[model samples]
Each structure stands twice: as structure tokens, then as C-alpha cells.
Target: MLNCLIIDDEPLALQLLEDFVSKTPYLRLAGKFEEPLQALQVLKEQPIDLLFLDIRMPDISGIDFYRSLPYKPEVIFTTAYSEFAINGFELKAMDYLLKPISYEKFLTACNRVNDFLAARQLKEKKEKDYFFINVSHKMHKIFFDDILYLEGYKDYTKVHLSGSPNPLLILHNLKYFEDLLEDKEFIRIHRSYIVSLRKLNTISRKAVSIGNLQLPVSDNYRDGFFALIGEHAK
Candidate 1:
């Protein structure tokens, strides 16, 4: 199912979107927020595929709020104003829906999202050979062979590379990165850590060494983590 979040200040608008979301079989309403900040927090905490965003909002405008996000999801702009049409497309919104959205218009927007998602998935399948990292606010492509280890902080994750002095600090949830890196080369030894087997130096019952750094293997993932990394301690 395609998970989605609706962000609009108007209670009525949120209700309408919620109703529309429920009527669609392929879409699942992950959450709805009258406050954009709350919606942002939910997006950060969960995996959301689509965002129904209103253009105008208090404190921070929707355009600015959307730009501030490190990751971009398929967006459909919902607003009463038509002035933001050009700006919305500049930000690459999937489609724009005028207020009092009709079921037909909503279906059109959903079709655009599905088409865009399909293209993205096809691209990922073709490039399944490499991973991408965020550095200086840009997605810097990195091959799977270059990673050394991963460390999780409160709101960001650090990716240590082969020859780079500083690891890339990506604005992401550990679990999100964990899901993105579930291939054979990467293994999560702890809730807060993932390591590249290509860079594995050593392993113990409690800790796994990658390069000069030693990360603890937590009890929760120790078994599956070791199995992937070739430590079958029966």
C-alpha cells in the first residue's frame, strides 16, 4: 500500500483529504495534521510515500517547509490559490489540486504519483549496484564497496567511507537507512549501527570491528547480524 500524510491547517480540508484517502484502495492514511510541523515529525519518524501539502500556512509556508526536508516524497499541492502553480512545479510537485477537490482530480494526481514512483523504482533496480549519500546537502553517489561502517545519532546517521577523513552525516532515521541498506553487503549489528562486510576487520561476542572502529552488537540483532556477516556461533 502507498502510505500518505495530509498536511493542512484547515480542519475541513484535512477531513476531506482523510475521506478521499479512505476511499482509495491503494492508498493508506498514515496520519493527518493541522500543523505542518507535526506532520514533518511524523514524516521523519515513519516511512511516507506521498504528502498532500497546502501551499499557505502560518509560521512557515508549505513551500519553505517542504524545501527544508532532507528527503523528498511525492507531493500534491492542495490550496485555494492558483498563484503557486509555477512555484509548485519548480519544486517538482506531482500535481496541484484546487480546493474542494473532486474525486476525478484526486485520481489524476494519484496516477501521476504512481507513474513517478514506477519510474523511480525502475531506476533503482537498474542502479542497484550503488548507494547514495548526502553530503553538503547533495546526494553524493557512493558504491557499496566504499562504505566502512554506519553510526546512528539522535536525528542523523554517519557513514564512514574508505578513504574519506570525515564520514557523511546524513539527516535520516537509523531504521530508514537500515531498510534502504538491507542488501547482502550491509548488516545492522545493533539498533544504532550498521557495518559493511567489505570493511569488516574483526568480530567478538559483543563487538564487531570495522577498520579501527569497534561497534557493539546489541542483543536484538546479534543473531541475524552475525549470520549475514559470516559469524555462525552455534
Candidate 2:
């Protein structure tokens, strides 16, 4: 089970998050904090897997509090302001939740955590890895390393495997794979595509090649993708 914490000055927000956490079977509420300093103390004392943090607390802002930590848990930033969306992501938050957060949206955040945990387990399993993904008629076993890339289409995803003649189409999206693979070993070079890092052979200004397939990099993602490759370059 994942240990979760809710840090919000508002009593109602904390209660709602606590209730949501309680209903989720995989999560255990470690503590709730009205102050960011108190939450930091809790982190120093024990392990926490996830944090639901409100951005505008009195003592220290949530973003500042999050940055102050020596080690950080996966955070879902909860706030009324949409202005903080980009900044929250820059902090590497799991998700940015707009408050008066709906139960459905909160559940979606929990699902993201679940997918993140599952992918970490699969990576740890390594040689023993096998992922069962539901397709049209039945579930299919997919080996982790054999996947070349995944492309998200409207209400569906097309899985491009290493040597497959055709893409295996499934009802999923880029978001599903993003949460499922967080080791930074897979990258979203395009809004719709997540490519396996191990599969990349050469990268140029416009395209990245995996084997003989040259995939175009979207303009918006180009700089970040280039920086990632440069940072990890041999």
C-alpha cells in the first residue's frame, strides 16, 4: 500500500482528500497537516509515497515548501489557480489538480499513482517482466523491452513493437503510458508518441531514428527532448 499525506490549510479540502484516500484500497493516509512545516517534520520522521498539497498555505507556499524538501514524494498540487499549472509541472509534480477537486478527478490522480507504482515494479522485475494489456477480444502479454513506441489517437493507442508488421491498436492514450513509465527511460517526443529510450539510434534537429524508422519530433517538445538526450548522451 502507498502511504499518502494531505496538506491543506482549509479543513474542508483536507477532509475531502482524507475521505478520498480512505476509499482507495491501495492508499493509506500517513498524516494530514494544516501547515507546511508540520508536513516537512512528518516527512523527516517517516516514509511517504504521495502528497496532496494545497498551493496557497499561509506560512509557506506549497511550491516553496515542496522545493525545500531534501527528498520529495510524488506530489499532486491542489490549487484554485490555473496560473500555477506550468510551474507545478516544472517541479516534476505527478499531477496538478484544480481545487474544489472532484472525486472523479481525484480518482484519476490515484490511478496515475497506481500506474507509476506498477511500472516501477515492472522495471524492477526486469527479466521477469510481462505486462497484460486488454485489447479488443482479450488481454495480451507484452514484453517491456520489445516495445518500440506507442502512439495515442483519439480514444485509442497504437502500439508499435520492435519487429511487428503492423501496430497493435488498443483503447488507451499517451497519459496511460506516461504514468506507467516514469523511469525517464521512455520519452514523449511528440504530444501523441512515447518512444522507448533504448530504441533510439540517432537524433537530428527534426527527427529521431530507431532502427530504420525516422520519427518526427514536434516543435513544442523539441527543446526539452533535445536537452534530455544531451543530458543522457554518452
Candidate 3:
């Protein structure tokens, strides 16, 4: 369900949008305001997912108000003016609703928001679960949590996993994995070793322990490793 907020100066326009939201099953009315200034107080206290906003208002324009906001929710700009449509889209407004908005058009915009959010959530879940890489000739699936450490030998790298007796050897070097896993929880501690920061057990001046393996922390990579682990640079 989407928590919706409406900001319109027109009393009749505000009432119509409220009625439209009431008819929709996915939309829950969080707050409704006749003035843009009145809605500012409610915005601070509420976690609004969607906004039905008026483009032209007495005190402030909706386009200016949205631009000033620190965190903007998905917005559907409601206005009679066709000229402001370009301005609304520039701010990444989800949809532009002209005055005399039909219930059918409102629903079509809501469905777009729902579909976009659903796809984003699915993508985030898959990213957290696994990352695939070339293992021999086939693309191998490896869970992020299963990783212990990676060891590089010349042009090849071996990925060590928890509960596994032998590591999976890949054609890629440690430098290749280091660049690929830059945003992942893995960090390079030595020239030959890249360990998962999540699977770390203990750390000392010159070494880090993941599972039973004691990987050396080279001087070149020591400062970066410690900084990433939230420790003062050694």
C-alpha cells in the first residue's frame, strides 16, 4: 500500500483527489492540505510514499517546493496548465494529471508507480543474495555469505567458501576480483588475498582471520583494510 499526501490550494480540487484516493485500494490517504505551507508540518512527521501535488498555488509553486525538498517522494503533478508539464517532468515527476482528472487516469498513474517499486524491490533482493562469475567454462552462482577468502596465483584466482573442502579456481586474477567486488563486502588485504569483510572473525596489526585461515595484511593495503573495517589507520 502507498501512503499518499495531497497538497492543493483549491478546495474542490483537493476534495476530488481525496475521493479518488478513497476509491483506490492501493492508495491510503495519509494527509490532505489546502495550502502547501500547511502540508510541510505533516510531511516532517509522516513517511509519505506518494504525493499528489498542485503545480500552481497561491503562496508557492509545487515545482519550487519539490525542488527545495531534501527527500522527494514519487509525485503526480496535478494542474490545469499544460505549460508546466515540461517543468514537472524535469524534476522526475511520475505523472502529470491535468485538472478534471478522470478516475481512470489516476489509476493508470498509480499502477505505474506500483510496478516500478515492485521491480526495484526484486532487483535489490537478488543483489543481496548472490553474484555470478565464470567458474571453468560455466557461469557459477555463489552466495555472498558463502565466501570466506580469495587467493590469486598469477592469472588464476581460487575462491574459498565456508563448509567447502576445496576452493573454486577461476581464470580471473585477484586484481580482477578486487575491481569486480569493490562495492561488495570483500576487501583486498594482501597482493594475493581478498577476504570477505562480513566473514571476518579477528584482526591484528599484520593479519586478519577468516574461518581457520590467517591471511597476511600487506603494508600497501593495510591502511585501506583497517579504514574499511572502521578502525584507525595503523
Candidate 4:
């Protein structure tokens, strides 16, 4: 299911979108907010897949709001003006709907969003299954399931395998590995550490244990780390 949120200052517009979203079987309405800042807070607290955003609002422009987000969801701009259409497309929005949006148009936009997500999921599945990295002038195929954890320092990241005593050091930052292994069962608990969720033996608020290694969970990534592990536990 696509978890969606609506952010429009107009009360009537919000109600209309809410009604339309409720009728759609695949789109689940996670929230509706008149204030963009409040919506941003809710976004941090929950997982949102799609956004129905208004272009012009009292607090901030929808374009700016979307740009400010660290992790952007698929967006469908809803505005009374047509001038913002070009800007919306530049942001790679799923669709742009004029005010007084019809159920037909809304449904069409929803279908596009569904198609985009499906394609992305299929691509991520292939990436997560296996990947190759250049180490010691050799390209090594590393399966996601065989990885235990990774440690990063400077521009080099060491990939630790399940049973290997020596790790493969690749000239890549932690952020590179984080994005590469995002869809796999791996969680970055600290700036220097990304551990395989499948290999985790125990977890606490401040730390996680993988085999005999106990890694610290930094304050910056603690909430997201815990959330990911909690989902894995289920």
C-alpha cells in the first residue's frame, strides 16, 4: 500500500482529497495538514510514500518544502495555478493537478505513482541481491546475505563477511555503502558502522550486538535505526 499525506491550506480542498484518497484501495491516507512545518514533523515520525502538496501556501512554497526534505517521497502537486506545472515537473513530481481536481484525474495520478514505485522496487531488489566492488585491483562479487557488517573511515569502507576474519577495504565512504545497501537488511547505527539486520543478535536503545561485537548507536541515527530494526523484528 502507498502511504499518502495531503498538505493544503484550504479546508475544502483537504476534505476533497481525503475523500478521494479514502476511496482508492491502494492509497492509504497517513495524514492531512494545513501547515507545512507540522507536516514536516509528522513526516519525520512516520513513513510516507506519496505526498499531495499545494504549490502556494501561507508558510512556505511547496517546492521549497520538498527541496528541504532529507528524504523526499513521491509528490503530486495540487494547485489552482498552472504556472507551477513546470517547476513541479523539474522536481520530478508524479503529477500536477489543478484545483477542483476531479476523481478521474486523481485516480490517473495515483496509477502513475503506483507504476513508478513498482519499477523502483524491482530495481532495488536486483541491487540488493548482489553487487560487485573493486578491491586490490580485482572486482569481487559480494552477496548481500553473506555480509555481516561494514566499518568506514576516511574514504575507505571495510566490508566484513559472515565468516571471513579479514575485511575487504574499498575506497568508498559510509554514505556510499548506505545508499548502495539501502534496500537490503542493513542498518546504519552510527557514522562509522552499518550492520546487517539479519546478523544482529540483540538491540537496545543505545547499542546493538552482532555476534561478539557491540556497536554504539549514535544520537543522530538512533531513531531511524531502532525503527528499522523494530520492523525487522516483526
Candidate 5:
């Protein structure tokens, strides 16, 4: 079910939206607030999938309130005025509803939200199979399996691959890739290096070799590294 919140200063408008939300099978009314400030507080504390927001509020305008958030939820703007429609769409609002909204219009907006969410999930799933990185001002599509290891310098990382003689220099830290490839077949053996477990050719007490490149296994990560290899041996 999609979690929803309503923020409208008008008592009648809030009640109408509450009624519509209660009747919808896929939507759950998380909260209804007349004060945008209180709604903003609830937003910070909870995860809301959809927002039904009023444009003009006494404390803070809905447009400004939405912009203030670091992580924005899908928004359907509710306003009596038509002037703010352009601004609302510019901020990527899912839909806009005029005051005294009909049930038909509301349902259409909800359907759009559902479609948007479904498309987003599909895109994210496809991204998990492969990722793109910038190399020499061009985006390079690198499959996880193609990567042999990663080397980190001060503020950049060198992506070493299986057949490439030269590594791709990317302006990102090793820690970024470490977190990105966490559950994938990659393990960080040293502060400045992460090696693909599948590509690891040999292991020693103090180091591991991927292809002809010898990378150090620091004491900080040695125990976990040994534990991982031990599992593979079993």
C-alpha cells in the first residue's frame, strides 16, 4: 500500500481529501495536517510515499515546503489558484488538483502516481545488473563481472578491468565503490583497494593477487577477508 499525507490549511478541503484517501484501496492515510510546519515535522520522522499538498499556506507555501526537503516524496499539488501550476510541474509534481476537486480527477492523479512509481522500480532493477561510470569525460558501461579490482588515490579511483591494459580513472573514492558493490562478488582487502572475489587469482598471508597485480590485504580487513575465502573453500 502507498503511504499518503495531506497538508491543506482549509478544514473542508482536508476532510474531502481524507475521505477520498480512506476509500482508495491502494492508499493509506498516514497523516492530515492543517499546519504545514507540523506536516513537515511528520515528514522528517516518517516515510511517506505520496503527498497531497496545498500550495498556499500561512506558515509556508507548499512549493517552498517541498523544496526545503532533502528527500522529496511524490507530490500532487492541491491549490485553489491556477497561477502556481507551471511552478508545480517545474518541480516535477506528479499531478495538480484544483480546489473542490472531483473524485474522478483525484483518481486520475493517483493512477499517474502509480504508473510513475512502477516505471521507477523497473528502471532501478535494470540498473542493478550494470552501472555506468565517467572515464575521460565519457560514460563507460562497466559490468560488475568485468571489474578485476579498484585502486583509490587521494580523491579518485582507478577501475581495473579484465582485458583493459589501462585502468579507467574515475573521480570517486574507493569507499563509494565499496558501498556500491557491497553484496556483489567484491571485497575490500585494503584501505585503498577492493578486489573482485571471482577474479582473485591467488592469496597469501599478507596479500592477494588478481591477475598479475598484487594487492595488499591490510590487517584491518584481513580477518573478514580470510573468513570469506574460507567459505569459498568449503
Candidate 6:
């Protein structure tokens, strides 16, 4: 089942989307929020597969809010204005749904999401130590052992390698890489970093060292990271 969230300022719109999610067998409603910021923690802590985002809002536009997210999910933009469709598609949104959405349109979007996720899960389940990343519009194979660390810069991540002098930059968030590398030989040491377990040269209470490079371990991820490395931070 695809877990979903709805963010709309209008009570009626929220209720409408909530009803649609409830009626769909494959879609589960994770939460609904009037303020986009209210859902930030939920987004971090829970697994959300899809989001129904309202385009216009008081403080933050839906487009901006989606861009700001560290963890991005498949999104369907719902708006009263047709002009916002291009912006939504530019951000790689699954669908652009106009306001006053009928059940038919909603179901169509849900069907597309289901199909896309089906393919993605299949791709992920493949047994391999290396995964392919899109680089310059082409799929580039990256092996887990070659990775030294990962650096995050907003929506972009830098894949540092053992032999390569320069890191490979990809259009993916740190959180995305964290999830992608889950159950693998990787541990997130900071909001902006993830390091290979086999590549870590040294570990301290507030930082880790790899290949002569030092990466700070933030307070948030300190304990979990230490435990993973089998160290007791003082």
C-alpha cells in the first residue's frame, strides 16, 4: 500500500482528499496538514509514498515547500489555477490535478502512482552491491565499496569515491541516499553526510575520519551512529 499525505488550507479540500484516500484500497492516508511545516516531522519520521500538494498557500507556495523538503515523495499537485501545471511538471511531480477534483481524476492519478512505484520497487529489489545513478542523463553504475562518503547540498548529493578525486554530483537529497543505502554498509553520521562502514578510518564523539577527511557527527545522529560503529561516545 502507498502511504499518502494531503496538504491543503481549505477544510473542504482536505476532507475531499481524505475521503478519496480512504476509498482507495491501495492508498493509505498518513496525515493531513493545513500548514506544510506541521508535516515536516512526520515526513522525517514516517514513510510517505505520495503527497497531494496544494499549489497556493499563505506563507509558502507548494512548489517552494516541495523544493525545500529533505525527503521527497511522489507528488500530485492540486490547484485551482492551470498556470501552475508547468511548474509542477518541472519539479517532476507525478500529476497536476486541478481543483474541484472529481473522483475519476483522483483515481487516474493514483493508478499512475501505483504503476510507477511497482517498477521502482522491482528495480530496488535487484541483488547487487552497486546501484546505477543518473549522471548527465545517463545511468552510471556506483559500487558500494567505491564510496567513501556522501555529502548533501539541498536537493543535490555528492558521492565521494575512494579512487576518484572529484565526487559525483547527483540530483538527489541526502535523505534519499540514506534510504537507498539502507540495510547496506552505510551509516548516516550527519544530516549532510553518510559514510561507508568499511571506509571509516576513525570515529570520535563528534566526528568520523575517512581517508584523511574528517566529517562531523551531529548531535542528532551521534548515538545511533556510534552504536552502529560499536563505539561508546563520551
Q: lDDT tens string, model 3, 189-225?
A: 9999999988888999899887677989999999888
Across 1-234, the per-residue lDDT of candidate 4 in tens digits comes to 999999999999999999999999999999999988889777998899999999999889999999999999999999999999999999999999998899999999999999999999878676657889899999999999999999999899999998798999999999999998877878898999999988989888899888888989999999898887678669
Query: Where in model 4 is the C-alpha error above 4 Å?
Result: 130-234
Model 4: lDDT equals: 0.92
TM-score of each: 0.55, 0.54, 0.57, 0.57, 0.55, 0.55
Model 5 agreement with the true structure over 1-234: per-residue lDDT tens digits: 789999999999999999999988999999999988887777888889999999999978999999998989999999999999999999999999988899999999998998889888766755686789787899999999899999999789999988899999999999999988876768999999999999988999899887777899999999999998998899
Better of 2 and 4 by TM-score: 4
Rank list by lDDT: 4, 6, 5, 3, 2, 1
Q: Candidate 5: which stretches are off by over 4 Å? A: 130-234
Model 2 lDDT at residue 44: 86
| Model 2 spans with C-alpha error above 4 angstroms | 127-234
Question: Candidate 2 residues 1-234, lDDT tens each?
Answer: 899889999998999999999998999999999988887778989898999999988888999999989999999999988998888999989999998899899989889988998898676755454579998889999977888988899778898987788989998788888777665477888988888888999888888889888888999889888887887876
Alpha-carbon shift of residue 196 in model 4 (angstroms) = 23
Candidate 5's TM-score: 0.55
CA-lDDT, candidates in order: 0.85, 0.87, 0.89, 0.92, 0.91, 0.92
TM-score of 2: 0.54
Between candidates 3 and 6, name the one with more favorable lDDT.
Answer: 6
**Model 3 segments beyond 4 Å from truth?**
129-144, 147-234
Which prediction has more favorable lDDT, 1 or 3?
3
Q: Residue 29 CA error for candidate 3 (Å)?
A: 0.9
> Please, what are the lDDT tens digits per residue for candidate 1 over residues 1-234?
789999999999999899999998889999998888888678888999999999998877788888989998889988999998788889999999998899889988998798789888877865687767677778899877787887899788998888999988888878877778775468888878888877778888899787677889899998887676565334
By lDDT, the best candidate is 4
RMSD of 1: 11.7
